[model samples]
Target: MRDQVTSSDRVNYGAVIALVAISFMLLRKWIAGGVCKSRACLDGKTVVITGANTGIGMETAKDMARRGARVVMACRDLTRAENAAEYIRRSTGNGNVVIRHLNLASLYSVQEFVKEFIATEERLDILINNAGKIEFDDLFFDKRPYSPLLSYKQSKLANVLFSRELARRMKGTGVSSYCLHPGVIRTELIRHILVRFPVLKIILSLPCILLMKTPWQGAQTSIYCAVTEGLESKSGCYFSDCAEKDPAPEGKDDEVARRLWEESAGLVGLNPRR
Candidate 1:
C-alpha cells in the first residue's frame, strides 16, 4: 500500500509539472507582442479615442502621444480620465493629451461630444472607436427585455457601421476612421461577469489565462490602423492583430451600414447625410 501511494504521488507531481510547462509555452505564444513599426510622426494629427481611460484605449493613446499626436481621451468618468491623461502625459512627456467626457450609451452625450470637438478642434485626423461592452440582449432595435449580451453585440456592430459611414462621408477629406478588434484583452471589462461568478474568476486566474493579451499587447492593431501610412484607402475595414480582417456578413452589408447610420443619426438628433 505504501509503494502504491508513492507511485500515485509521483504521477500527480509529473502531471502538475507537465501542466506548468504547457501553460508557460502557451503564455509565451499568447503574449508575443506586436507593435506598429511605422516611424511616421503625427506631429499635427489629432486622435480621439473613446474609452481611453483604461485597457487597450489607454495604451493606444499613449502610443499616439509618443508619436507627437494630440490625443483626446473621451470617457464617461472625468476623474478616471484625468488620472489616465496624467499618467500618459508623464509617461510620454506629451503635454498635448487632453480628456473629454463621453458616454456612448447616451445619444445626447455623443452629439454633445461631436459638437464640442468640432467647435474646439480644427482638424480630426483619426477616430478610433475602441470602446465596446458585452451586455446581455441589448440589441438596438429589440423591444424584448434588456439582455446585456445582445446589447454588447449591438454596440460592436454599431462601431463597424459608424466607421463605414464615416469613411464614405470622408472620402475626399483627410480624416480617417478605423474599427478594430483588440483581441481578448485582460481588463476590467469582464469584472462584472467575474464578480457574479466566483468559479469563473478562479478558472480565469488559472494557466488558461495565458490566452488573454495584456492591454498594451491588445493595442497593437489600433496603433497600426492609426499611424500606418498607405492605409488611407482602407478606411472602414475591420482589423485584428495589426492586420485587416473581413468582418461578419452583417457588418459587411452596405444597406445595413446605411440604415444603421440613419438610425444613429436620428438617435443623436442629427440629420442623416448620404
Candidate 2:
C-alpha cells in the first residue's frame, strides 16, 4: 500500500531540511573562528617560518608566498620540507620559497640554522616560530611523572612568557613579537596521539572533523599577526582568532616571564643580558 503524498507532509519535510541546512551553516561559521581580514601585501619582505612543511606552518608559508614574500621554510625533515617548498612555489607561482633544516629539539641545529641564515639572507622581516612539539620544561614538571600532554602545555606557557619578555626587550628596535592560540586544528599532531593510542583514532574521528579547525583556519591569526598594520602598538599581547586576547593570570606575570627568560637563556647558552 502506498502512502498518500499530503501537502502537510511535504511542508514538514521542507521545513526539516531547511532547519538542518541552517544549523549546519551556523556550526560551520562558529567553527571557522576569526579570519584575517587584512589584505596586506608582503612584497619585498623576507619571512622565515619554522615547521613550514606541515599544518598551520605550511599554510602560513603559502600565504606569505602568495603575498610575494621570500619565505624560508625551516623544518626538521629536509625531504618533507623540499616537498612543501615545491608545493608552495607551484601553488603560489612565487618561486621565492626556500627550504632549510631546523631541528628545534637540538640546540646545535638552532645555532647552525641561525648562523647560516645570517650569512646567506640579507634581511629578516619576520621570524615566525611556528614549530612546537610535545616537549618539556616543568617550570621542567613539579617532580611529576613525565607526561607528553603536560610537557606540551608547559612549553606553550613558556612561549607566551618568552614572547612577552621579548617584546619588552625588543621595544624601539623596529621589531615586534606576538604569541597566539591556534584553536586546536586537525593537524599531524592528532596523528601522533593516535599512534600511541590507536583506539583514539576511532573515538575522535567524528569530533575531530566536526570541532577542529583546518590548517588554513588555524593559520589565520599567524598571518594576521605577521602582516597586519597597527598591530605593532599591541605587540607582546597574546592573540587568538586574529584579535588581541588577554592570557591567563600566570601568563601575564611579568616577574615570572623575566625569570623564565633568564633561565631559558642560560640553558640555551645565550646572553639575554644583552
Candidate 3:
C-alpha cells in the first residue's frame, strides 16, 4: 500500500519535529547551566586549570573562584598566568588564586608543574586539561602550500592522553582528573586557522559563531566536571558542553594511554612499579 500524507498532516509533523529539536537544545543548555550553579559543590575545592590565561579556561577559573573554589591558573608563561590570576582575584574578590607554570607539549614541564603542585598542596580536588594550540602554516602561508596538517590534532590528542594517564596515577589519591573541550569558542586559538584560510575561515566560523557557546558557555562543562557530585567516578572522561564525550578512536587505546603514561613517567623520572 502506498503511504500518503495530507497537507495538514505534513504541517503537524513538521511542527512536532521543530518543537522536539528546540526542546532538546534548550534542555541541554539548562542542564549545563544547572551543573555549574550548585553552590556548595564547588566551595572550598581546589581546581588547577591549564591555559587559564585566556579564553574559556580563564572564564572557568573566574567562575569557579566566584563559587568559593581555590583556583590555580597553570600556564607556560609565568607572567601571563599571574596577570590572569590577578584579574580573577580582583573580579571575584577571592584571593585564593595561585599561578603555576605548565607547558603541555613538554613532558618535563608538566612534571615540574605537578611536582610543585603536589609539594605545595596535600590534596588536589580537580585538574582540568584546557590548554591547546592551533598552528596554521609551517613555512609561511603560501610557501608550504598544501601539506598534511597534524599539529592541532596532535595537541588535542595529547590533552586526552595526558588526562587518562594522570587519572591512572592519581587513582587512589582522591584527586579527580578530566579533559574538556570548550566547544570551539571564538578566541585567539582560531586566529591561526583564520589567517591561513581567510575566506574559508569566515565561512566555517559563521556557523560555529551562531551555534557555538560563548567563552562563559564553553566553560560550563569543565566547571560541571570539576564540581558535580558523581564526577569522581567519571575520572579520565572527556567532556564537552557538560556531557561525557567519547574520545577519538586513538584516545580509547588503553595500550597507547599506558605507553604515554610510561613515556611521561620516564620524562618526569617517576619510576613505575613493574
Candidate 4:
C-alpha cells in the first residue's frame, strides 16, 4: 500500500520545521539582547546585590555565587532573601552567600547595613543597586498626580547621573561605577502591573513572552558590568544590552551630575567633600 505522502515530502516537512525552530531561537536570542561572555573569575571578590531575592537581582546573585564570589544579598525581606540565598548556595555549591537587611526607603536602615558590612568585611567590591524604591514625601511629588512611568524614567536618569559622578570622583582610585538599562523583563514588577488589568492587557501580556527577556536574560548586562575586566575606563558610560550607550543630553551634563551628587549627599547626611 503506497502512502499518500511520499518520503521526499516528509523530509521537506521536517526541513521546514527545523528551519522554523532555528529561526525562532535566533529571534529569541536577538530579543534577549547581549550576553556576558566574560569568564573572569571572581574568586575572593565580594558582590553586594540589592533586591537579591527576586528578578534579575536573584539571577545576578546566582551568577556571582557560581563565579566563586562572596554574594551579599541585601533585601528588605529577610525570608525571601534567605530562601534565595539558600537556593544559590545549593545550586552553585557556594556557601558564602549571606543576607543583610537593607531598606532603601529609610536612610537609617542603609546606614546600619553599611556599618555591619564595614565591621565584618575586609574588602568591598562590586555593588549592584539592582532594585530599590525610596519613599518620596509629598514635596517630592509636588502634589501632582503620581505617574509610575514618569517616576521610572526619572529614576533611570538619576542612576546614569549618579554613576557618571561616582566614576568621575572615583577616578584614579581603582573604583568604578556603571549604570545599565536591562531589557524589558517578565519580572514580578511587570507582572504586578499587567496582572492588575489582565483581561484588558491580555494581548499585551501574550506578546511579552517572545518580546521581553527573562530575569536571567535581563541580568546579563549587570553581570557583564560587574565582572568584565577593563571596563573601569568605561565607567560612567550608560550601557544597554551589555554595550556602552550614549545617554540623554541631560545625563551628560557634568554640572548637573555634580549638583545632584551634592544634594543627594546632603539628603543622606553625608558631608559633600572631594
Candidate 5:
C-alpha cells in the first residue's frame, strides 16, 4: 500500500510538470507569433515617439535608432527618458537619441512640446502617438467622473484622431503619422492598477507573465509602420502585428476625426484653421 501511494504521488507530480511545460510552450508560440522582419533603414529621418521612457515606446525608439534615425524620446519622466535614451544610444551605437518632455494628460504640455519640436527640428519624418492611459473612475476637466472603460477607450480614440488630423494638416509635408496597437505587452503600465487590486493581480499574474509580448515584440508593428517604404502613403491607417488592420466602425468615421481635431486644437490652444 505504501509503495502504491508513493507511485501515485510521483505520477501526479509528473503530470503537473508536464502540464506546466505545455502551457509555457503554448505561451511562447503566441508571443513569438507576429514579427515585422523589415530591414529598412531611416538614414537621415527624424522620429518622435511619445511615452518612450519605457515599454513598447522605448523599444520602438531603440529599433528606429538602430536604423540610423534621429529618435526623440518624448516622455513625462525626464530621468527615465534620459536613461532609456542613453541605453538606446549605447545599444545601437547611435548617439543622436534625445529626450523631450511630453505630458500627454495635459493639453498645455502637448502644445509646448510641439512648439519646441517645430522650432528646433527642420524636418519631422515620423510622428508616432504611442502613449496611452488606462484609468478607472477618472474625473475629466469637467469634474464629472467617467467610467474606467470609457476613459481608457477615449484616450485610445484620441490617438487615432490625432494621427488622422495630423496627416490631413501635414498633407504636403514630408512627415507621416502612424498609430499602432502595440499588442498586449508586459510593461509597467499596469503596476499601479495591480497594486490597487492584489487579488486581481494574483489572478492575472501567471497568464500575463506567460502570454504577453515583451516590449520589443510589442513594438514590432510600430517599427514596421515607421520604416516600411510604401507606408508613407498609408498615413492615418491603424496597424497591428506589422500589418494594416481595420479599426472599429467609429474609428473610421472621418467626420468624427475632424470634429475631434478641432476640439483638440481648441484644448491645446492651437489655431484650428492651421
Candidate 6:
C-alpha cells in the first residue's frame, strides 16, 4: 500500500517548494567577504569597477571595501550608483566608497569617466571590466534571419578591447587592467530575458544555478587579479575565476582589438598621443 497525494496535500507541497526556492534565491543575494590575510596589503589602494551598481560588481566592490581599499563604483546612472554606494557603505562600514559616472555603451562617456578618474587620482591599482549584456530576442533564437545579437556581442568585445588598450597605456604606470566573465548570475542584466521568455529562462537558469557560480564566486576572479602578488606580469590576460581564460575567436583577433582601440579613442574624441 502506498500513500497518495490529495488535492490539499499537493497544494501544501507546492507552497513548500515555492518557499524553498525563494529562500535559496534570497541566500544567494547575501554576498560575503573574501579571505585577505594581511590588512596592510590593501590600505590606501584604489580600485575602479565598471558596472559596479549591481550583480557581481556590487559584490566585488563590497568585498574590496571590506578589505580597506578605496573603491570607486563607476556606473552610467549617477543616482543608481549613489544608491549602490550608500548600500555598500552601510553594509561594509567603509566610507571610502565613491561613485563615478561611466557608460560603456558610449565612447564619450567612457572617455569622460577615465578623464575624471585620472584627474582625481594619481595611480590606479586595479581596473575591473565587468559590464556586459545578452540578447534573448526570439529572432536571436530562430537563428535564421537578422538579429540584434551583434550589438550585444560588440559591447562585450569592446570591454576586452578597452582593457587591452588600457593595459598597453598603463604598462609603466603601475596600473593593472583586468577583465572577467561573471558567469551566469541573475541580475537586472538578465531580467529582460526572464520577462520575455519565461520558459526558456527557467530552463537556462536551472542549469546556470547547477553549473554556474554566484556573483561573489564570479567576483573572486577580479579580486584575485586585483590583489594577488604576481599579477603584474598578467596584466593583459583575461580571467575567469582567477584562472587565465583563452580569448574567444573574436577576442583573439589582434587586428580587431587594435582597430577597436583606435576607433574607440576617435569616437570619444581623444587623440592618442602615442
lDDT of each: 0.75, 0.78, 0.69, 0.77, 0.74, 0.68
Clashing pairs in 2: 137-140, 138-141
Q: Which parts of model 5 have CA positions greater than 4 angstroms off?
A: 1-27, 103-144
Clash counts for the predictions, in order: 11, 2, 0, 0, 0, 0
TM-scores of the candidates are: 0.78, 0.87, 0.67, 0.83, 0.78, 0.68
lDDT of 1 by residue, 147-237 (tens): 7765677777777777877777777766667777777778788788889999878977865356678788888887888778888778777
For 1-274, candidate 5 gives per-residue lDDT tens digits of: 9999999999999999999999988878777556888898778877777888898889889998998988888888999888898899999999999987765876667657766655442333343333333222332625565566566677787777677777777766766677777778788887877899999998998888877888888888877776677677787777877777777666666776787777767766877777
Q: After superposition, how far is residue 138 of candidate 6 from its true place, in Å?
A: 22
The positional error of residue 152 in candidate 4, measured at the CA in angstroms, is 0.9
Give lDDT tens digits, candidate 3, residues 108-181: 66656766555432334343333332232332235545433454565566667768877777887776678776
* TM-score, cand. 5: 0.78
Give the Cα error of residue 265 in candidate 6, in Å.
Answer: 1.8
Stronger candidate by lDDT (1 vs 6): 1
lDDT of 4: 0.77
lDDT by residue for model 2 (13-116), tens? 99999999999889878888999988888788778888789999999999999999888898889999999999999999999998877669654466577656
Question: Against the true structure, whose TM-score is highest?
Answer: 2
User: What does candidate 5 score in Cα RMSD to the true structure?
Assistant: 4.9
lDDT, candidate 6, 210-270, per-residue tens: 5456676767766676677767777777876456777665555556566666765665677
Candidate 3 stretches with Cα past 4 Å from truth are 1-35, 41-45, 78-83, 100-105, 118-148, 193-208, 267-274
Better of 4 and 5 by TM-score: 4
Give one digit per residue, the lDDT tens place, for model 4 in 1-274.
2464687788899999999999989989898999999998888777788888999999999999999988889998999898999999999999999998877975446656765654332322332222223234442557778878667766666677777887888777677778888888878876667778878577877777877899999999898888887887786777889898777677787887787777777777776674
RMSD of each: 5.3, 3.9, 8.0, 4.2, 4.9, 7.8
**Model 2, residue 48: C-alpha shift (Å):** 0.2
Ranking by lDDT: 2, 4, 1, 5, 3, 6
